[model samples]
Target: MMSLNQVCPYCDITKINKDIVSVDHLLPKASFPVLSIFPDNLIVVCKACNEVIKGETIYLPIAHPCYEEVSRHFTFVIKENNNNKFTIEIATNSKNSKLINQKIYNFIKLFKIIDRYEKYMTAELQDYRTAVRTPNKCVFIELGQLTLLPPNLLLKRLFHSKFQPCFSY
Candidate 1:
């Protein structure tokens, strides 16, 4: 069995101390019985992202966010306007656009992650707004311009810090 501390191969979020949730097959195991035990087919995902993303579908061609280097396949774009509000856009049309879009849509609808995490996302947006408005000169100078990293990396870092013991084994 894979360790619970294993970073989610899909989201790259640490899963050490957090509730283990479940293992997700990169490919739907039931649909591909022959490859059910394939190492390449398995991924650890947080319960929220997994349950929300996995709907009725059995097969998805999109790269698993955890184990697979899916960052290469997608990009995030942030836009700010005169009103000073910011909007986040996840690029869906990259090399794996069709496949990725389908998987993303499925994930959004099935997992209801958007709805479930609306408050969290909103709070983060507010933080960004404050940062932009106040402009922390010292921190910005020391750290350099804060580039928004992908969600996977953010999740991974949060998971790692919060659940350090999970990585011990």
Candidate 2:
């Protein structure tokens, strides 16, 4: 997670505490029983992206957003309407075009990410504002070094983002 910067590649539009963090078998264990413990077949994702959205579902032969780097295949468009509500859409500027767009579209729709992200856009923006307005600039880097955490998580701890430790272990 630290390597991925602690953000679930799928739908980490909101802050994720450890309890909801889970391991996803890129190839579902139910389908490929042999790959259940295969390190290469695993991807760590938040509970929502794992259980709630993709449980036992397979999107293989497409992009897994990890080794495949979905961001390279697509970008996001954050649109703000007159009502100040934000909407996120997958961009159509993929160098590979059609198939990539469709894959990302399917992933987003599967997770209802536009709606989920819209629900927390304000809070995310608020956190960003707070970070920009913080009196200490060096502290973020300092904290990251001290905790060995990634930038996004450093921001979460520094700004006290909406997270409660839900992990039992």
Top TM-score model? 2
Pairs that collide in candidate 2 are none
| Per-prediction TM-score | 0.57, 0.58
Per-residue CA lDDT of model 2 for 1-169, tens digit only, reads 3444366867655345577677888787888999999887787778888888778876534566666565455444555567755565655453676777777666667667667755655465445444544564322232114123432353355344543323223
lDDT of 1 by residue, 9-77 (tens): 544433444575666665676677787788876656776455656633543444455544555544444
Q: Give lDDT per model, in order.
A: 0.49, 0.59
Q: Which ranges of candidate 2 are over 4 A from the true structure?
A: 1-5, 14-18, 123-169
Q: Considering only N, C-alpha and C atoms within 3 Å, which residue pairs clash in candidate 1? A: 9-66, 9-67, 10-65, 10-66, 52-111
